[model samples]
Target: MKKLFNNYINTFKGLSIEVWWLSLITFINRAGTMVIPFLTIYLNESLDFTFKEIGWIMPFWGLGSVVGTWLGGKLTDKIGYYKVMFTSLILTGVFFFLLQYVNTIIGFCTGIFLVMLVADTFRPAMFVALSAYSKPENKTRSVTLIRLAINLGFSAGPAIGGIIITSIGYFALFWIDGITCVLAAILLLQVLHPKKAKVLDTVKVENPVSVYKDKAFWVFFIAMFIFGFTFMQYFSTMPLYYKDARFLTEFEIGLLMGFNGFFIFLFEMPLTKWLENNVNSKIRLVTTGLFLIAISFIVLNFTNWIGILAIGILLMTIGEMIAFPFSNSFAIERGKKGNQGEYMAMYAISFSLANIFCHYFGMHMIDKYGFEFTWNAMTAFAFVGVFILLILLQILKREKAQQNL
Candidate 1:
């Protein structure tokens, strides 16, 4: 056991302070997001908001995230990664704590939006820092490891939030989340402090309108947007469905989200490590994942049994673990060294778009057609995403080959 432990320690010796620090950032931020798994519940039950109201407020959160993505990327490229990351971390913590005072719907929505915006801005800077710190040989593995830390944090946070919410109410969850983020930010300030890189090029950034001219980038973005649109509903609409159906309690919902984190912790490393070099691995894994997501949601409508819901949740978790990392790594691999921040910024936009559309459309669809129809429609959307992603992968492959020639 002593020899094995020594080997484990030695294995990580090749990793830099920057990579380790970024992992800490991811873990801390993910812990804060645990409160989000229950935010819809809190708003509905504690603050007396309707699903439609939540949906309307949802786009503001996405808009905040978009601001984060843009600012983090641009600032990381201009000033430095550590500066942007550290600032965002502190801001995120402050806003999360502010949620405690928000009683009205407008205040609540504004609080959530600001918190997400600040929290999300750290992401592009974090990813760019990780990529900058890693050797080319280990880039993909480094990305996977960071994601592993995030999932591990997610696993712990939801379970902890569940207990806190049950014992002390929703305010306690926000407080703990805020405190953890501050602690993590302090750690970031102390260790893995990244020096500013000398700018070697001044490539003009394409405006949003001009950016759409890149067919490949658009293809990737659209694919991710569709995937996110279907998957993000789990955080909002699906929880309400399960609650209304009496298939889960507040704690149970937290437990279900925790289960996703758990399996990712247990399984994702070996799975990604095995799939890393193989051609089309991203496409295959994500395809399977989308299939599982579609199937799980479809299956949920027929059963009110907690056991069946648990099984469906497990399936969703499996799909998530496969697709999330694969898509991220795929985007990184396709990007140039100097432009990684830009690529990640664009990638982040996909999820924001997903949240906006999923919440906006899913809420309306649920109101008109009910949970069964909404989920079924989302399943179809997931399949369409799968098809789009695969086609894009094929196109990317051909483009690469042509460039090689």
Candidate 2:
């Protein structure tokens, strides 16, 4: 037990204090993410929204994320990460408070869009800051530590959110979420300095179009979109499945969803460290992760028993633990010195694009074909993503070899 405890401590040994502080900020911010997980329930049960109307409204949140990440990347380059991070956190909190007053579909949709736009700007800025704070050798572990914080908070959020939704109602979710965002911003203000936060010591601006011109990055972008779309079904469609198909309560659904976070928190950091030490190929690790994701969804076709569902969620969480941070690390390593924010932004946009695709198409599938078909389709998508990413990895290898020659 002492040996095990010491190994865990050794995994985090060499990182800077800034990295630790950033991880704390991530934890606090994500701990209050009670709104979105429960938003579907709120729309369906409270507002009497059909799945179709909810689908329409959800894409606006994705549209806002797209805009926010793009603009945030540009701002991170021009003005710097600190200002963008500070403004995003504080304003996002204010918007969450504003959302509590919106009752109509139009009003709710608009509010969601504005809130996400302000909130999601923090994503790319945070990635840029993480890269800035860590050494190259420690990059993957650094990002993993931040993800550890996020999953820890995520594990807490939905579990607590379930209780809040049951006892006090959805309005309380928003108020708590808003307050936490404000608190995270206040904490961030104390630690992050403008001079220290700049990703590049001497700024060399690159045109945003340069990312598009990199053929290998374009392939990577497509793979990210494919994988992201498949994974996002957890948010857009899975909750409805738990409620309608399995006949579970909202609290039960929250527990199942929270299980994903809990599983990752228990295993991800140590697993990532082990993989980094033992694995030689990032491509193999990512492909295996995607395949695991496909299998997780495919298994759902055979059973909806709670135990089976927990197993499936565990597989999917393992896939997420392996794939996501490595993908981010890959993008960051490939990026030019001054273009870190833009590279990370493009990666972030793949997730936003997935949000749009999944909610629009996923809800439609569930409404028409039912949950079984939806899971099968997602499984097929993951398989296709794996194939494409394999080819892209080969292309990247050849490109690197040629450059070396």
Candidate 3:
């Protein structure tokens, strides 16, 4: 048991202090992500909004993320990750407070859009900073470490948000969320100098290439969109499912969601380390992750058993653990040659685009058809991604062989 504990601890060794600081900042920011996860529930119960209306409002998060990440990417390359990240965090905190007053559908749509625009600008810049802070050899583990912080914060945010919602009301979540974002910005300010090499450096490509022109990345992007669309259902329609089907309270649902983050916190880093050492092909590893997530939804329909909910989350969490780190490594490596911000932004945008479509699609299907059909539709979509990504593995290999020649 001691040896096992030590082995797990070994996974995090040797990373630079700046990388640790970045993870801390991510943890704080992610921990305050209370509003988005519960926004669907709040819209339905408190404001009496229809699922379709809620769907319309939620896509703004994605729309904002798309624009935010793009702007962030450009700003990171031109200015620096430091300024962009710090400003986004502080501005996003202020926006969260403003979002509290937006009760109408249009108000929410605009509010969420504006909030996410500022909030998501941090995503690409954060990753670029991650790439800069980490050594190339330890990059995947470093990515996993950051993800662990994210999941850890994710674990805390919803569980605490649930308590606040149940004890007080949803209004308090905004204060907490906003305060934490500003605090994270302050923490970032404390940790590193503005012009530190890792924080501020942007390499110039001999002749920069357009991220849009990268055919291979576009293929991967499509698959990631499917992955995000399906994965996002956990926070969106899945909560509605728990409320309607399984009859869980807000606190219970938060615990369920928190379980995903907690699971990742405990297991993902060691798991990622093992996979990095053992796996020969990162693409194939991602394909397996995609399948696991697809299968997680099917598990829900497997029985009328309540325990299956836990099982489903477990499967989905495992899939997330497998897919995300290597994909981060792949994107960072690809962006290393030139135009890092664009590549990272494009990568983040795929999920942002998925965010746009997933809420609308999932809620529409659930409202019109049923959860079973909705689950099946998302499953089929992910299976398509699985097949497409396998083809991507072959494409990556061919591209490598040609480059070698």
Q: Write the per-residue lDDT of candidate 1 for residues 227-307, one digit (tens) a residue.
A: 788888887688888788655787888777667767776666656655665645666677777788888788877776668
**TM-scores of the models, in the given order?**
0.80, 0.88, 0.89
Q: Pick the candidate with the highest TM-score.
A: 3
> All candidates' lDDT scores?
0.75, 0.84, 0.88
Better of 2 and 3 by TM-score: 3
Top candidate (lDDT): 3
Candidate 3 structure, TM-score to reference: 0.89
lDDT of 3 by residue, 269-297 (tens): 89998898899788798899999999999
- Number of colliding residue pairs in each model: 0, 0, 0
Worst 10 residues of 1 by lDDT: 196-205
| lDDT, candidate 2, 1-405, per-residue tens | 999988878888878778888999999999898777678888999889998898778878888999899888878776777788989999999998889888888998889888988888898889888877787777888899999898788777887998998899898998999999999999889887754543332335454446767787878888889889988888768888878887889889878987787777767778888999999777678788888889988898896566778888888899999998788888877665337677788989998898777777888898899999989999998999999889987997897799899
lDDT score of model 2? 0.84
Using TM-score, rank the candidates from best to worst.
3, 2, 1
Candidate 3 residues lying further than 4 Å off, grouped into runs, are 38-55, 101-107, 162-172, 195-203, 240-256, 302-309
